[model samples]
Target: MWRYEKRLQYPVNISQTNPKLAQFIISQYGGPDGESAASMRYLSQRYAMPYDKGKAILTDIGTEELAHWEIIAAIVHQLTRNLTPQEIEESGFGPYYIDHTTGIWPQAAGGIPFNACEFQSKGDPITDLFEDLAAEQKARTTYDNILRMVKDHDVCDPIRFLREREIVHFQRFGEALRDVQDHLDSRNFYAFNPAFDPGQKPCGCKKNQ
Candidate 1:
């Protein structure tokens, strides 16, 4: 049994729009390395995790990723600001403008649609956590790359925020890894993947060893 909270971890307000930058940032919004994929991957993978701690981390992180997905969408909206009808048509934003009218949609920079194939949800806890950790770093790197590509303060601010979040998430996953592995039997700690051995004690906290 799990409890879920529906809320964004942060707020996003993009006051201006630049369609050019919007196109670029949309990659992180809906691309394979986007927050949308990251969130979905972790949350979906939680169901297969064998331990409560892993499940808790996955749910929390997954929910947060949804918020991040929203934030990225907000950034895209901001970046696509003030497009005239002519500009929209010339810039090839007309198709998007027709449907969204400055609203956010999940699609890559090159207009590649989002798909579930971007991520995985293996039932194994250790494997899943490792994947999550890598995902966070990948997102962080993407944000950094975005920052490098753009000079807008509005875009950079949110991108930086997202980048910091990746660092924080990586730390949390590290702690979760420690919690899960430390619980294993001392003798078998290094014998195999730590998540598979339930016989391992919690935290390896033996007082009389």
Candidate 2:
């Protein structure tokens, strides 16, 4: 269960409405490297994680990513607010308005809808951690790209915060990966997966005396 918080993690108060910019920013909502993908990636991967520390990391960061998703929704909502029909048409938000009427929907800047294929939840710990590490970096890059195009102070502020969190997530995933490697069965850590493979020493298990 999650506790409800009425306040945003970061405030987004845009004085100007810019649907064009919102179009670009929406990608991080449900786009490939978006918060939605990041949240699902870690949470889903947590089920198979071999270590509690890794699980905890995934839970903490995954929940945070959900909050990040809310922040993005807020940004898009504010950006697209108080638009005239003419403004919407001229800004090239016509296609979106017809579908959702200024509602929030997950999709990339390029117009591709959010898809599960965007992130992976591989059952293997090494594989999943590597995937998480890469996901965080990619998400960071997305925020970086957003920053480059953003000129408004209100938009830039929260974008920067999100970008910083991505770096922290990457560092956390790195720590989880290192922990996994350290606990691996040295004799066969490379030979087989202690998480799954049998007929071999499992990580964290003692040999029969």
Candidate 3:
């Protein structure tokens, strides 16, 4: 159960319309590394999470990813709103306009419709968490690419916010992974961590240094 908030997590007021830019940003809405996949991946994986910390973080981040999706949607909407016929054709938005007509639809910039294959929900917590870490980085990289192309402060500011959240989410997931590992029994299958951090105490979750 979620408490419905009528406000965006971060405010987005894009005064100028840029259909070309919207075409690229729309990928974050439904692309492989997009928030839509992140939300679904984490939420679905929580069911198989053996650790409470893992479950909690997954739910928290999953809900937040939904908010990120809305943010992306709002950005895309604002950029494409009030499009003229010539702007649509020149921006190469005609195909999408034919289908969505400025409405939000789940598809990559290349027009690949979002699908379940975009994410994973493996029952293994370690595997899923590792997958999540990679996902966050991928999203951050996508945001970095967007920031490079975006010239408008109004557009890049909110995108920067989203990018920062990706980095934060990556950190949070890292903490949750360490927590889950720390709490595991020696006899557990995942107890033998092949990827254990070097130059760190084996009992690694307690220190800040």
- How do all models score by TM-score? 0.79, 0.91, 0.88
Better of 1 and 3 by lDDT: 3
Rank by TM-score (best first): 2, 3, 1
- The ten-residue window of minimal lDDT in model 2 covers 193-202
lDDT of 3 by residue, 1-209 (tens): 88879989999999999998999999999999998999999999998777777889999999999999999999999999888999999989899999989999989988999998999987767888999999999999999999999999999999999999999999999998887677655466365332353223456466578
lDDT of each: 0.78, 0.89, 0.89
lDDT string for model 2 (35-144, tens) is 99999999998888778899899999999999999999999999999899999999999988998899999999988999999999777888889998999999899899
The top-ranked prediction according to TM-score is 2
- What TM-score quantifies how close candidate 1 is to the native fold? 0.79
lDDT of 1 by residue, 108-170 (tens): 777788999989877666677788888888888888878888776767877888899899999
Better of 1 and 2 by TM-score: 2
- Which pairs of residues collide in model 3? none
Span of ten consecutive residues with least summed lDDT in model 1: 193-202
